[model samples]
Target chain A: MENACCIVGLGAISSIGLDVEENYESLQSLQSGISYPEFLQTLHKTDLPVCEIKKSDAELAALCKMPLGLPRTVYLSAIAVQQTLAVIANHDMSKLRIGFISGNTIGGMDRSEYFFTDYLQNQSQGQLQDIRYHECGSITELVAKHFGIKHFVTTINTACSSSANAMIHASRLLKNNKLDIVIAGGADALCRFTLNGFNTLMILDSEPSKPFDENRKGLNLGEGAAYLMLTSEAIRSEYNLHKYATLSGYANANDAFHQTASSAEGNGNYQAMKEALAMTGLTTSDIHYINAHGTGTGNNDASEGIAIQRLFGENIPPVSSTKANTGHTLGACGALEAVYACLGLRDQVIFPNLRFETQMKDLHFSPDTKWQATKNMQHIMSNSFGFGGNCTSLIFSKDS
Target chain B: MGVYIQGIGNISAQIFDPRSQDFTLHAGHGNRLICIEPDYKDMIPPMQLRRMSKIVRMGIACAKAAMQDAGIVKPDTISLGTAYGCLADTEFFLQKLITQDESMLTPTAFIQSTHNTVSGQIALLLNCTGHNFTYVHRGHSFETTLQEAFMLTQENVNCNALIGGIDELTNNAFNIISRFGTYKKEDEHFNNEGKGCIAGEGANLFVVNAKDTKSSYAYCSDIHVCSTENIAEELDGFLHVNQLQASDIDTCLLGLNGDERYDTIIANNIRNVKNARTISFKKYCGEYPSSGAFAMALACKLLQSNTTPMNLQDLNAPLNDEPAQRVLIYNHYKNQYHSFILLNRL
Candidate 1:
């Protein structure tokens, strides 16, 4: 089979670690990154825990070589993107028609909130510059400029499923022969606005998230950025480089069941998974591991589990939700988990779904609670479902 | 691959129905803000209507109208593009968090605050769980969705895709934008009187299909979205890639919103596209983030009607028998992000 899109390099910053190696090390050790919020100044810090990246905005700005006063999201994205690009530094930045697509939920909210308070005090002159960064696109534009990418840049903000859709979009563009090199992923930073928003919804877990557990509470908010360098087969062959994993198939569907809650039957999730497998020409038996969205919410886990059960039947693959490790990174969760999927292939290990006790009575399947290495890791399917019933499934395979 | 615009619906400052002969223009309310309050109850059911924000309501209303216009009961896909999604809800949630100290914040506002809420709601409403996505790339948000629709068409995946772009203005949102100096102050609008205009909100939806139905208004030939500091170089590169010369463009729709700072950049590019008729829509639609969607809707109507609306006609070029063969829409939001869309009548 011809590889549709090849992942050349990957980078990520999460509560687990700062880079790919660090995150992989933490994952292999079965360490959870969910802890009390430290950096974000919020009133609910004590009540709600978060998977926050252990870095300040100034430190991240310095790490990304960004100027002072840059939006915190941009700074985080630049660090992750720069790390990914470092692996492919020999590639011609000027000759290659490079493009970027990022998914971020609260783009530049850190800056927007700052200016929102200032505007109320009648201080508005220097504020226009911040306005440019208020929308999701501004982060993409800033990252593209920092990386010297000049073509086909945009941002997708479909909540938790944003970066998964971003990855799908990048793959489709490459399959259509639209560009040579594309950087696709998502980044998000912990903020008081999001912290309180989730808290108000009464979905924030007081303790660490227990995904797929019998007594699972709500999710723990997280912040991070991750990106992958996707190139076509021709480009990979010309460069004489090894592709980590082939992004074989991807699909997105709307749950449309609710504004926030998925349907009881998980129709959208089922359709997305079915379409993705169908596109890849693979059956449920071919898949060795499943990276579930498993936000630890009562509704999401139950709905997603039902959908997975419907698709795979009794022959369910070993499944784990990385959200227990990285928290629910929202827009960046998809990309963050994509990096973890590649790691699963390289290491031949299925990371544990931490804090699982008993299976839900509604479903027979249970996520792998212990990390185990397997040889037949050919295909790994990951699911990312967001608000607005936006659901996406991505299939990655070792053999192209 | 041919993608036809089967249905078009828009809710802007002006009446955007294609059947209408003239724009049902409204008087500017004192500060240069133009708003169109649609009777959304006609399109949305009362049960679902109560929960929707202004952006969601406008989006549902416009999407419903577009589906009706296309005579399609169920669309295969729903794709929405919004520069800022559910800002009103977002602001509400944020305000609750800040003012109430994050206690008892309503779930409704938080639920509708995601960027994909509109597209998700549309899918849920139609119960069409096929393919759904949303793009939030500022000025090129809708164009990116159009590009994705074209790719889907080329793949023969779905026959029809409902694509739309929407943005709503809230008081906090406007104030935030004003603080950045991106928005014209009330004093500036009052002093210049007619010089600078305030921002507005709107929703534009289109039913795009792979087949070229006779009802097609025009064919979207190509769309190019790039981020560059040098406007001249980017413009030249876009035209060169399409194998089109500057003179080949019969009319160029420029995004000029009376802001002298940014309008000059567009003006300089228009001057380079020699022998092409120029037009602007900012005065009519105001300067919202996704105003480009409104511009695209106007282009479709112009191609179909064979006449440009008088309110939008900046350059008085006589209509020719050539039938507005090629139309180029050049849009820039905040003078930082730019997009160019090329459309040709089939």
Candidate 2:
């Protein structure tokens, strides 16, 4: 279909790796990147494990060729976006109607948190430059302006589902002929604000997260940025682009059950998965694998597991949560997992759900804990459920 | 096909009601424009009201009000745009995390601090399990939300999308932003040739449908976003795309804040517009990032009432006194992000 949104380029920066190739390598070897915070200066750093990218903001800035003292979010986003654009460097970018749609929970909060430490005491004490890019759009603008993306630029902040919605919106825009190419995904940097915020919620597991495990404690906070260059099938054909995968179906549904908790019945999760599959005109058996949101939280695993059971029922696919390796990256997780899904489809492999032992009693299926090569793996489902009851499911089909 | 604004509910610096031909614009207090809020008891439940921050309260109240005005108990989708999301909650959590060393922090403030809290709350309140999204793209936040809603309606004819734009002006935000010189001096207003604009906060919600209903205020014909460079060319293209000309527009609403530095671009662009009565909305709603929403609401009001409000001003040369059948809204933020919205009388 000419309306199909094709993923032509991929970029990612997380604890496991700095770019898509490194991330894929780490995933293949089951190299978990969870460790205690070394770069982040926090009181709870010793207790809380995180998927830090193992680089300071200065190192990231050096990599992105941008100035230091800016928010880490900017550096991460710039690096990922640069890598994404590098894949399409052979194409005449200026000739195409290009746009950038990014998703981030806190714009420059990494810098703003430092500014707030002083400004909270005295309004005039903080550096103006530190807090200048505090708005989420500001991060988007800094990157877009640097890369010269002036056509369409926006930000989505639906908690964890932020980047998933960004991809969804980008596809809609492409399907509607609003833009020929869109760099759509999200980024986030580890900071005290989110650390303590999630800490206060008491969902921070002391160890690396074990998603879908029966004895899962909670989610370990992680930080990263990932992006996918999506283009219309027409543009893909015209440019003879190297296709990674096709963004077949997606849906955003509200749980409406609680402010931060998923429903017991996983109503929103079920609806999002159901609707996404419906959009693809595919049945449960058509889906080859599932990348579960599976935050390793007691609430999320149960709710999401029950929803998966309700949807696929007896013929559940090999489901796994990569958060065990990357930790829950929150806003960036959706797109991060999406890149991984594309990688899985490309290689016809199912990356195991790391550190899973006992299965949840609420469901009949256990997440695949061993990496294995598979045949005829055509479609993979990625789930992202966030705070405020925001649930989104995205389905990616292997390029035929 | 264009989407119709079936209903509007605004909680802004001004008292706006589409049903009322005559309305009042409350004067801003010092350098900031505060919303003249309504009682929350009527719109939200008491228990839920206590947990919600000021922005959430205003957002949910106005969303419910818009839904009620649209004569629907639930909408097919709920989307919101907020530039500064849940400032009070964010500030509360940040301050507590700082002062108390993040030791005894609670989850309430942190829970409410996310940008989608308001939109999520609206969905939870109505038990409307549909598509929910929140855009925080600075100036184009609301316009992006409107665009998303418009696309949904165009894709699905039976979709009724509840969309809104909201932002709150907290004390800390005001103080810090004042340091950035975003607001005029305390002694200065628009009339005094100020270098900055007043800080404004508001929640404007609308129920839009692809099919026009009896309660529809106006039909939103087109919405376009463009960069600062080649704005005049883009403006002409926008009009041409809509099968219109400068003369076809009865009223052109420009986002001209009192700030001379930023308003110059808007001022310079108006030269390309001819035979259209130009109106500035910042004078009434003050200046906020998503104030384009207020401009669109005002355009709907003018179209619905068929009479101009008492205190409305024409920034450009006066034109014929005919009621506006076609309205064009041009808004830019920091001269960086610009959008044009066209509305027509039903």
Candidate 3:
């Protein structure tokens, strides 16, 4: 029998909040964390709005009890993973086989870009320590070592959908009986490299993002880290764990349409949602809420909306894009939104999509724009699509 | 279930033409072993080829060649691993953005700077809308790709996975990594006792299926990656689970990169094995995060030919006269990321 992956703990550190409780409170009050950049060293700070965490790198390091000079990505990840490990503080976890699967597009580019400024001037001038954590895997290794997780650790980079893939890979490990507990998520820090990269693509919105809206200009880049602690069914039963939800179904599909853009018809989006639902043996009407991958971009919202319409049709559930609040945390959005989805099941509340005024012309359904209490919410779906046409949808069902 | 290596393609420091009998091994040139790239005119169109970065071109060429060798038009899945992905493009955009003050920059380099660009471009070129994935773990990157491919084939019997591992060594990357004592100095001698190994880069791809076919090179039975202190015990457990022993392995491909710090893991395992012929592969391909792909390709070549290649006869010592049937590949990166892959002939 295939083992069911259970979500026992959740940790999140984003622009709106520092912990899951803070995030939930913000979601309850319909507060958006989108603002101008204060920490990232970029020239377009005034012109570009981002969902940047207010803490500086040094502040974050001090807060997380980590070394001062490590990459901000490491600091953010340490904070989130620390919170995640807190759930099992009373239990001795060293005996269990734990796996750490982290996803990120930018590893230490926040510092590597600074290293390059000097190295590009003179080949041997830059400090080698700055580029030490340049590889994406290095971030995971540091965080894993910090938490003393030594069994199995890996890194995945599938652009914006990176963490979603990490969670899926973690579930696979659980199903294969390779691990007892898996902490999977992703983290990305705002750096000049990615900011300029998005700017070059003409996708950075000057204002707060408006996902699933007719006037959606583009996505505001964000920085954050989030993680979900999953365990095998056997481990869950053995521990008699307090379950938030069961990661009942998930799937990954390739659009193959474009490198950075989604197809108009959302082929990959449709396939991923369909496959995930099929895995859960659930029909369209069963999903009570959807945390859409609506990045407020012209291509993503329309494509995702069309896919939702095609799948749910007249019986579309309460759908909302938290990107308006979180400002599209890139690689971390998948797990971050996943935590929100679990909160929807736990607290029975459907978080609102902020700044959404007019509906898009292609879709018939309008997203939920106000925070409302939902009764008897059973299953919530979280969608994450990224560059390279990587699309993933994860379904979390309330524990009966 | 084990997966069959139906086809293989590699672009490495050594000459990698499968049809040609002559395999020329290139020595490291001043602490770097650069890939002897083949002309991509035949594999990629001129218009699209113009905009591709070096790693992307190498990746696409290898993927296409592997597909041709497998005689398949499309694969059921596309997955890959790269430690330093599209370094040239990343450097280009970052340099331009910094030099131009982050204004008036073009999007081409920025668009291709992502780590998944090669896998994405290959999917775009092939129009294969399968489940695409990319892994960026330092040393275990390629092993994770293989594991995912194995799981896909295990889940769906009809799945054919086109998977590979690729890394490109750019000038800036080499210089930065060199500062961290990752590579030998240009004036230093190349010896096992040295502190650093030669830096290298390549793209090695394979077409894998669940069942053995007429063109099968070898069957990958098991793969494991972990960070452990007692490698000898781990090796015993791995072999025990696979229903094998140290003596059952005919040959063991060891990643003995010249560095003593890194080679200790492989050295510790070599002391425990009894009868397996130990051979180090880093001399041919040098040291990179995903160099295990090159080692796997070499293992597949040996298994397919049922004999040692002439170029690798003196890796550590002369190969055993008997034809090898089973091979074990053990590799590690910076003494942390350890992996073992077991391959056997049909």
Candidate 4:
């Protein structure tokens, strides 16, 4: 039997809020975080809409109790990790063999860009310390150092699916008896690099994103951090920890079709969902709610919608994309949405998919437009698909 | 569920096979030791080569060669490790954004700038829909990749994973980092003594499978990664689990850069294992995040022949005994991340 990897603690910092409860409160009221850029200064700031956290770098650093000059991503991650440690505060962390696996795409581009801007005009103007944060793993390393975690710290960078992959790897480690406790999640901060990158792709939606809608334009790139404290069932018992949810099933697959786009049929998406369900020994019927990847892009919603129908068939349950609530966070979306799934399971309420008027012409069902109270919300399936055809599906079961 | 290395492909500072009986050494002088990369046309298509950076070229080449040596068209999974991924592209795009206006910037460089591009590219080329992963921890990058691969063997008895560690050296990166007093100085430089590491870069790939084959070099017995202060305790615990003692390790491959600040962890961990032969690989390969992968390839070569390379011997710590069965590798990055890998001769 596969060992159960229970979720004992959860932390998230998005545009909506700085902590789990605040974000959940927003979700309960169907408050979306999408807005005009505030802190992210870019040429496209006036042109594009993004779900940016309304905090200055100094403000974020103060919130995390860290010094200035820290990367925005590091500050965001410190907030989330603080919240995670808060929930699991009573447990003796030193006794357990802990491992931290983080998912991040933009390591410290925000800082690096500033350094480069200064250095371009003058060769020696850029701070050398800022360059140290360029690698994706540095986010986790810095966070780990702050928390005094020394074992098995690493980072994953698979575009949007990075955090979900982090969760999968963490669960595997716990199940395989490599680490007793694992904190796995991801973080990314808004910067000119991502804004221009998405702009160059011409996928930044001018208006708020409309996921799973026929009139959906494109993704509204967002930024934040989310982390989950995962522990083996035995460790939970030993610590007498309260379980928020149990990571019942998870799987990853490559689309092998395109670099940034999903296949028309969403073959990789279908395979991931199938294998995730297989891992849990559950059928499609067991999933009560589905948190679709739904980036609100023309290709993703259609592709993911098709894959949903192919997997669940005529009896598709309450399904929606929270990307409409929180813009596509890229690497952070996986864990951000996973936290949302956990919230849904705990609250037994499905957050409304903010914007959906007409059903997507290509799909049979439109996303649940209003907040729906689900009955027997035992299992919630969350999907995160990213660039390079990386697709992942994670199923969270109610803590029984 | 034993995992054995079935194939090896390396693009070190010198583009040579470690498994070859006779190999040419690329002794780099001074503080920079860039890789001697192969022709792009040899592995990638003409159009593909034009789009990739040097790191991607080396990554794809090594991954393809590993698969080729394993006699498989596609691997069951693809895992890549890079401390600083595609820095040249990242730096290039950053320079353009700084110099040229960002309004008309193209997405090609941005699209290819992500850390996961090489692994994704490999998966796309092979059309393997298996799990694709990329790790980006500093010193523990390759260790974490192999650790995850090791864990995969427990889940599935029959699994084949294409694992690689790649990083590139750029003049700008080198110049910028050298200011931190990281690289040794030999002249009127930062240190003014010019005794720093010869900054090296390369991509090393290995095909690891649950089952051994005729081409298998050695069995990868175990691996451990930690970030604690207890180096000796961790080493003792790791060897204890594998039914090994200090004397059992016939060869100890240490990640000893010329820098004295970083060699203490390695020195203490292997202090009790005085009976085993010790070799330092950083001299030949230079120092990079994933140089451990190159060290592992070198360890595999050492296991096959039990003879340490002439260029790899640590002059101060020469071996009194010949290598035999077991080789233990210990590597750390500036006292932050530590990794241990144990391999046994096939």
TM-score of chain A of each: 0.97, 0.99, 0.99, 0.98
Worst 10 residues of 1 chain A by lDDT: A117-126
B222: Cα error in model 2, Å: 0.3
User: How does candidate 4 score on lDDT?
Assistant: 0.84
- Taken over the whole model, the C-alpha lDDT of each candidate is 0.82, 0.89, 0.88, 0.84
Q: What interface RMSD do all candidates show, one decimal each?
A: 2.1, 1.0, 1.0, 1.3
lDDT of 4 by residue, B134-247 (tens): 998888788878887887866776778989789898888887777777787643211122245557787999899888777888999998875567888888888899998888
TM-score of each: 0.94, 0.98, 0.98, 0.97
Stretches of model 3 off by over 4 angstroms after superposition:
B18-24, B187-189, B314-318
Query: Tens digit of lDDT per residue, candidate 1, span A86-128?
Result: 8678765576677899999998887776665555456443366
Ordered from best to worst TM-score, the candidate numbers read 2, 3, 4, 1
Candidate 2 - CAPRI tier? high
Candidate closer to the true structure by lDDT (higher is better), 2 or 4: 2
Error of 1 at A78 (Å): 1.6
* lDDT of candidate 4 over A1-400, digit per residue (tens): 2566899889999998889999998888888898889788776667798999999999999988888897899999989988887866765667778888899998989989988887778777788878778878888888988887766788999999999999999998887787888889999999888888888888889999998888988989899999999998888888888888999998999999978889999999999999999999989999999999988999999888899999999999888888887898888999999998888888898878888887889999888888887678899999999888899999999855
DockQ ranking, high to low: 2, 3, 4, 1
Note the DockQ of each predicted structure. Answer: 0.66, 0.84, 0.81, 0.75
- Candidate 4 wrong stretches, greater than 4 Å: B186-195, B309-311, B320-324
TM-score (0 to 1) of chain B for each candidate: 0.90, 0.97, 0.95, 0.93
Output the number of the DockQ-best candidate: 2
Model 2 per-residue lDDT tens digits across residues B161-274: 999789998988888998988889987776557489877888999999998878899999889989549888889899899888788887888898889987878878767677
Candidate 2 error regions (>4 Å): B26-29, B319-321
TM-score of 4: 0.97
What residue runs in model 1 are displaced by over 4 Å at the alpha carbon? A1-3, A117-132, B23-31, B185-197, B227-245, B306-311, B315-323
Q: Using lDDT, rank the candidates from best to worst.
A: 2, 3, 4, 1
